[model samples]
Target: MPLENVHGDPIFTKINKVKKQYEYLTEDIETDVAIVGGGVTGAILGYYFSKANIHAVILEKERIAHGSTSITTSLLQYELDSNARELEEYTTLDNVITSYKLGLKALDEIEQFIKEYGNKCKYEKKDTLLYTSKEYEVKEMKEEYEIRKNAGIDVKYISEENNPFSLDLKAGVYGVNAGAQLDPYEYTHQLLDVSCNMGLKVYENTEVMEIAYGKDEVEIITSFGYKVKAKKVIIATGYNTQRFTKRNFGMKTVTYNIATKPVKSFDGWFNKILIRDNCDPYNYFRTTDDNRIIAGGEDVDFYTNIENEKLAKEKYSILLNRIKNMFPNIKDIEVDYEYCGGFISSQDNLGYIGEDPNHKNLWFCLGYGANGILFAILGGMMLSKLYKNEIDENLKLFKVDRFDK
Candidate 1:
C-alpha cells in the first residue's frame, strides 16, 4: 500500500535538519541480507547488520524516512500500549517483565548510538508520566504502578496532592530514566549514513514487487524490473506486510496527530515529561526540542477507510480538544501541523520478530505497538545475533508463532 497519503504532514519532516540523499537501485545487487523498508526499522537493522560484518542493503520505495517514520511522535518509552498489568493476561508475568526490560535496554542502545555518532536527532532522555484524571480509575493506575515497582523499575506513584501538573489527577506513575523523545526522521538518516559508510548499500525509489524464496537465498523483484538476491530478507514494511504474508498477525488502525506552534510558557508541566493517560485509546503528548507541543491518539480502524480528510479534520479537532483538556494553561495553542498515519497492533501487544517459520532466509521485524521504534531496536539486535549464529532465547518471546502456542 502506498503511504504517501497515509502519513500526512507531520511536523518532524517539516523542520528536518539532516539532508542526506541516496541513489535509487538501477542494477541487480547481491548482499548477505536485504532489508525491505527504509524507515527507522530497516535503518536500524542495516546498522546492526553492518556492525556484524554482514553485507546488507536497504531498499526503499520512496525517499528514506519519508513514510510513517516522519509521522512518528517519537515518545520513546519502555512501556507498551498495554500496561504490564494488562499484558500479563495474555502472557506470563515474567514475560511481561522481560518485555518491559527489553524496551528499556533498547532505549539504552539508542543512547549508546547517539553517544558514538553525536546527537543529530535532537534526542533527549526524560521521565514519563502515566496518569488518569478520573477518580474511579485510580485503582487500575495503582495496579500498573505496583507491577512496574515490583519489577524493580524506578517508578513513583503520585496522588492528587503530589501530582506536579496543574490538572487534578487521581493517580499517576512517574517513571524515571524510562522515557525519551527523538526526531525519527533525523535518526533514520543518521543511522543510514553511518551504516552506509560501513558497507551498507541503500537504494531509494526501489519498490519490491515480488519475492521468490529459494533453498539458499531469496530474490526480490523490483518495480522497475530489477532483482535483488540475498542470503536473507528482513521485512520491515510496517502495516503493509499483509501484501506478502497471508497470516493475520496484526490489525491496522488509523491514528490522528497534531503539533502546536512553538510556545513560550510551559507552566505546570513537569520537566516537560512525556505524558499519557489511562483512558482507552489514550491520548499521548510530548514536547519537541523547539517547544512545540506534539500530541496524538484518536484512532479508528484503517481497513474500513483508506484515507479520509473530513474524518481526519474531525479527529484533529478531538485531539486539539484533548490537549486543551489536559493543559488549559497553554493559551492560544494554534496547531501548526496535523497528520494521520497507519500503525499495526498485535494480539499480544508485542512486536513480531525472528524468521518466519514457513520461509527460509526470510525474517520479519514488525514492531507493532506504540513503542515501535524501541522494539525495532530490539529486533535488530536479536535478528543480527540470530544471523550470526548466536541465537538468544529471548527471541521466543517475540516469535511469530507465539499466538499458536
Candidate 2:
C-alpha cells in the first residue's frame, strides 16, 4: 500500500523545529524486534525496548512523526470514549476501572521520562471536565461522577447551580490532576533520540513492502528491497494496517481540529481545563503552552481519500464556530491552523496490544481511540516486559483476538 495523506497542516509540525534526520535503509539489517512505524507509538516502543537491552529498529514509510501523530490533540486523560455505565455493555465495570488506573499510570510514566530527560514537549499536568449542556443528560453525568469517585479517583461533581466554567452545564465531572497535554511531534523525537543513544536504529523513507514469516523469525522487505530479519515484528502503523492483516480492528473516522492564535486572555475558561462534552460526536478543548486554544472532534466516517478538501472545509468551519461559541468571552479567535486526520476506536474503547494468537512472532501495539497516546504508553511498558518473558495481566484486556469467535 502506498502512503496516504494521513494528516493536513498540523499545528505541531509547524510550531516545532526539526531536531534530527534519519537515513533510509541502505543495507539489510537484523534485530531482535522490528517496529513497522515511526510515529509516537513506534518511538515509545523503541524507548522501552532499548531500555530493556533489546535490539530494535524502527521503519517508517515517510518522515518520523509526520503521520497521524502530527494531528493528535495530545489531550491525555484517564477517561474512555463512553461513561462507565455505557461501557459496561461491552466490558466489565471492573475492567473499566482498571483501565482508568492504567491510564493514570501511563501519565506518570510520561512525567517520569520528562523529569529524567528534559521536558522538550511542552508537558503540563491539568484538570479535565466532562460536562453536559442538556438537562436530560444530567443523570448520566452524575452517574459518571459517582463511578469515578467510588473507584478512588479524585473527582468532583458540579451541577447547574454550582458550575464553574463559562459554558452552561446542567452537570459535569471535574477530574483533578487527572489529565495532561503535550506536543506529540516533539515527544516522538525526544523518545527516538533517547532510544538512539541506547542503541536503537531508525530508518525513514523506508516502507515495508512485504513480510515473510518463518518458523522462528520474520523477514521484512523494504520498498528498496532491503531485508530486515527479526525474531519479533510489531505493527505500530496506527490505523493503516490492511497489509498486515485482514481482521477489522475497529471503526476508522476522520477527526477534525482547529487551533487559534495565541490569545490575550482566557476569560472565563477556568484553568483552561481540558474540556470535553457529553455528546455523540463530541468536541474537546485544550490550551497550549503558548496560549493557543485547540478544539477538535467533528468526526466523519473514514474513506479511501481522506484528503477531501470540500468536507475538510465544512468540518473545520464547524470546529471554528464551536470554539467561538464555547468561549464567547475570549476575543479575537483567529484560526491559526486547520487539520484533520484518521482515528480508530474499538468496541470497548481500548487498544489492541501483545502477540497475535495466530501469527507466531507477529505482534500489534495499536493504540486506537481517544486514549491512544496513553494506550501507546501502556503498550510500551507491557510489550517490553513481554520481550523479557514477563506477563502483565493487563495484556488480556487488550488481546488482539478478543473479538474473534
Candidate 3:
C-alpha cells in the first residue's frame, strides 16, 4: 500500500531516463512561494502564481513530476468518487457543489491554457464516454446523470451509437465539457517549461528536510544542505509530507495499470474515455493520440504472501483477454507498460488544501483518491484568490482540520 519513508514508484528510474535537466538549488535562496514538491500541484501552482506576478519557486527532492504524477494513467474525466453526492452530509451543500464544479472548471482552464500556450505537451481533447455492457446497468447511469446535473455539472445520457467506444455499449454518461487525455510526462513537460519561462525557479534533488513556519517568512532545510526563505510554502510532496504534517494522510490502498501496444488494424478506435459499470474492482481506459490504448483498474489493497510481481502479470493478462472480448478486431497487441501504486488517499476522498490550520503562511495541496490534476487546478485558482485577498467562501471544506475530533 502506502509507505512514506521508502522510495515509492518502481517506474521512477525509467522516467528519469528521458527527463530534461533543470536548474539546481545549490545554496540558500528565497522566493515568494516555496513549493516543496514539483509534481502537478507544484507546477500548476507556479503556473497560476506567475499570472498575477506572485512568482513561486519549486524545491523538489527529485526530478519534476517524477513522483506520483508520472505513474498516473492520466485520464482526465469528471467521474469522481461514488460518494460525491453525499458531500453535503459533511460540508455545506453549496461548497460541496462548488468543489465538484471546480473540477470541471479546472479541466476547462487547462484546456484553455493548452490552446493558448500551443499545447507544449501531447494534449488531445476528445469525447469522454462512460458506458456499460450489462443489460440491467442503464439505471445507475441515469441516476448519476441526474445527480451530476443537480451538482451544477453538465452531464447527461447519450444514445448507443453516439458514444465514443466501439464496444458493446448498453448505456452511456457523457460529459460534453469534460474528458481529456494527455501524456502525463508531456503535460508536466510543458507546464514546467512555460512556468520557468515566466520566472518560476525550480531546483532538483533538493528535499525539504524540515519546515519552520514563521509569522514573517517560512524557512525550510533542504537535503542538499541549503535553507530557503519564502513568504509562503505549498506542501505538494505527495506521501513524502506524511511525516511533516500534523495530519497523517497516508494509508494503505493499491491501484494497478497496464497499457497495450499500438494497434494498426484497429484504426477506427473511438476517440473517447471509456469506463465500464459494475466490472467490480473498477477499470478506466482511454485512447492515446498515437492510437495506443491505455486501460487499467483492478485496484486492491496490498496483501502478504501474494507475489506482487507475478500477480501483477496475471492481472494484466486478465485485462488483455477482457479487452479483446469487447473489441475483437485487435489481434495480439503487446503490453507496453505495467504500473501499480497506492493513491495517497484522504479520509473522505476530498483533498486537504489551503493554509495549514496551525501555520498562517504555510499552505498545502493534497488529494484523496481522485482530483490529482483537478485539485492542483483548484489550488492554483484558490491560491490566486488568496494572493489577491479575494478568497472564496467555499474553500473551508477542504481545510486541514476538517476531521478534528
lDDT (0 to 1) per candidate: 0.87, 0.92, 0.70
Clashes of 1: 0
TM-scores, all models, native as reference: 0.97, 0.98, 0.87
lDDT of 2 at 271: 89
C-alpha displacement of 304 in model 3, angstroms? Answer: 5.5
Best by TM-score: 2
* Tens-digit lDDT string for candidate 2 (1-405): 324645567899888888898999999999999999999999999999999999999999999998889889999999998889998888999999999999999999998999999999999999999999999999999999999999999999999998777787899999999999999999999999899999999999999998999999999999999999999999999988998999899888888999989999898898889999998899899999989999999888878547688988898888888888878898889999988888888989999999988787899999998998899989999999998899999989999989887
Clashing residue pairs in candidate 3, if any? none
Ranking under TM-score, best-scoring first? 2, 1, 3
lDDT score, candidate 3, position 32: 87
Candidate 2, run of 10 with poorest lDDT: 1-10
